[model samples]
Target: MLDDATLRQLSKTRGQTLERLRGVFNAGVGGDRIENMLYRLIGNKDGSRDLQGLAEVLQGRNVKLWVVSAGTNNLQKKKGLVDADVDKMRLLLDTLLKISSRTTKMLFSGLTYRTDIGDQLVDEANEKVCLLIMAMNQEFGYARIEYLPPVADLDKGQHLADHVHLNERGYQMWAEILAPRVMELYGS
Candidate 1:
């Protein structure tokens, strides 16, 4: 979990700024406008949020949000967590329970095939994070939860980069699997 300060700091790093700008621009388009809506829907496949709109939704739903992603390092360092991280995760989960209007639902994922140890580490970490999400869902009595598994053949050169993040094809596969489950669980 990154502090707001930390996320801001990370945003200043070269690539992260571009990523955040892209996130902002992509999330800004409304869903009612045909062209913009299609663009936003395509871009939001991996669960993009307009921070302002998301905050509004949280207010509307009376829910607080927390997301945990599996990065490459989280895998290799399994069972070697720092106490600070453990505490932060616990606090974040607890806060979600306390703040959310309805019961919470956690979204998590497993490790994927990767080209490098770093990617593998992210995969490993994500696996652990997923487990933690499950435990939290149970512990806090979430209304619902879901786990997205790694694509089996993803490492076969279908991915664009380090094989950690997904390409559009990978995202589509992900959305197809996830959207239905989320709809079933939350009634979409």
Candidate 2:
């Protein structure tokens, strides 16, 4: 999960600096792709569970926010798969939106710069990822969905050490930026 402790830390800071808010929930899994997430949602695998299952599990829990950081794994191929991936993502988002209360807010983190895997195919794939983000924001509107840009110049080593995953500093920066927005949405 890209150092979600940073997010927890950010939430803690928010409670200290602002209001006494509940802690953050870290439901992220490492190396999770969009397709894999769909599989998990439907319980297609032995140990995986679908979104309905997840909702059932968290039936009584107070879930006020959801932050999604996916689609980077879908960017290793060509442009042909972009539409399919976007469609799947839209379905996933729609399902989540339907399940959540109107007060719940969602944030989608955009794919960062990939400098290590500098192939033509990867570049094309990144372009598609950006397009997917744009389309989702345009279609859903800010009231329902918001997009978080990469923490820093991802091409630089400080933000993304491996070109794909966020470094420690990157995570901290990301959490710092996102915490305020989360507060705004949650408080409203």
Candidate 3:
């Protein structure tokens, strides 16, 4: 039960207050666009200070922006269209490329293992999600593709817990494998 002034103040505060509760209720309806508002405020033409801006200050050079996403389902839901999700992802990528053609590279990976006690249905859903990931890479030529082979069963435990999330060791290895490719693409 917020009044207009309180609602306006909440919107101005970037959702750190109860007045901003409207944002939570309106979540996922252009959620990406909404989230980008935070990014916009920090270190760009926007009026907020953030890490990216600080790096630009320290380096005495403009900081380039790059986004690497994993576990994006936490950010945006595909509404259980598990099988066709990849295609939808591809369409979104295409739109992004159109807007920001400067995006130099993308590093896409497939699900390699799972041991979560969540449910069998989620495991099956992940497999379908992986299929979409593969399809997205194949369908579009926006960025270089580097296929990371699934780790063998013995090595899977080193990289994954509950067959899905990366353990520290696995993430370290994943970063090691991905870093060179990303560096080469960005010419870093």
TM-score of each model, paired residue for residue? 0.49, 0.68, 0.42
Of 1 and 2, the candidate ahead on lDDT is: 2
Which 10 consecutive positions of candidate 2 have the poorest summed lDDT? 11-20
Q: Give the worst 10-residue stretch by lDDT in candidate 1.
A: 22-31
lDDT of 1 by residue, 19-117 (tens): 331112112221122222223223343456632323233334443223333232332334433344444544544443444555555454444555544
lDDT value for model 3? 0.38
Specify the highest-lDDT model's number. 2
Candidate 2 C-alpha lDDT tens digits along 1-188: 22354344444442234343576556556667776766654444344642344544544455577777776677644353367887887766665566667666777766655565444555455466566656766776656666666554443566665756666566556666666776777666
- Cα error, residue 102 of model 2, in Å, equals 2.4
Tell me the deviation in Å of residue 44 in model 2.
4.1
Please identify model 3 stretches exceeding 4 Å from their true place.
1-81, 116-158, 161-163
For all predictions, the C-alpha RMSD in Å is: 13.0, 4.9, 14.5
lDDT leaderboard ranking: 2, 1, 3
lDDT for every model? 0.43, 0.60, 0.38
Model 3 per-residue lDDT tens digits across residues 1-188: 11233224323432132222111212122223312423322346544743452223323222222223322232223233243444555544343333333443444443344444333443454565556545655666433333343333325446554444455555555544544554555454
Which scores greater on lDDT, model 1 or model 3? 1
